[model samples]
Target: MVKVATFFAMSVGAFAFWQTMDKIHVWIALHQDEKQERMEKEAEIRRMRAELIRENKKRESLA
Candidate 1:
């Protein structure tokens, strides 16, 4: 019973400590990386769209 109570107290203390750590720097870094990723994704999507348009034109010609 005592070990269980102590474990619960330690767990709560660890949780409280983790909740207060500064995360703005980490968040900003992630956001910057995410922005770069989004830009790259957008470029890829545009390229795919252009390819699809070309394929559609070819199909139309075949018909």
Candidate 2:
């Protein structure tokens, strides 16, 4: 009887631990995706700024 009760308790604990790990994995994946998207947006902004600077310099030289 004692063994059976101990087994049940361990099973429950293992299940709870598995669920917690799954949630953590999903959270990490979501944050990583968001960070990648942010990095891409920042790169695009930098590119646009560089292009604008180049164009302004060209115009100033022509004037």
Candidate 3:
């Protein structure tokens, strides 16, 4: 009886651990995707700002 109870408890614990790990992996993946998107947006903004500065300099030189 004790052996059966112990086995059952261990089984439950292992299952819980597996589920928790799965959720953590999913969260990490989502976080990484968000980070990548943010980086891309920032790069685009920087490029736009650089272009605007170049255009303003051209206009000033012409004037």
Candidate 4:
């Protein structure tokens, strides 16, 4: 019947939508982790720069 075929198509479409949503969620989570790691690396670089500046200042004071 036409009604039964329509129902089957809708079900398949819903399943495909669910699968796509799951993949999107996984991709978003992966990108979020990468962003966090990049932020942490930037913070470490800033900290190292500050430390070097302090050491240079101390050496200049001694001279």
User: Clashes in each model (backbone N, CA, C under 3 Å)?
Assistant: 0, 0, 0, 0
lDDT of each: 0.92, 1.00, 1.00, 1.00
The 10-residue segment of model 2 with minimum total lDDT is 1-10
Query: What is the Cα-based lDDT of residue 38 in candidate 2?
Result: 100
Candidate 4: segments with Cα more than 4 A from true spot = none
lDDT (10s digit) by residue, model 3, range 1-63: 999999999999999999999999999999999999999999999999999999999999999
Per-candidate TM equals: 0.54, 0.95, 0.93, 0.92
lDDT of 4 at 29: 100
Tell how far residue 32 is off in model 1, in angstroms.
Answer: 0.9
lDDT of the structure predicted as candidate 1: 0.92
Model 2 Cα lDDT, one tens digit per residue, 1-63: 999999999999999999999999999999999999999999999999999999999999999
Give the residue spans of candidate 3 off by over 4 A: none
The deviation in Å at residue 29 for candidate 2 is: 0.6
Q: Candidate 4: lDDT over CA atoms?
A: 1.00
* Candidate No. with top TM-score: 2
How large an RMSD does model 2 have?
Answer: 0.6
Off by over 4 Å in 2: none
Question: Per-residue lDDT for 2-35 in model 1, tens only?
Answer: 9999999999998877765547667888999999
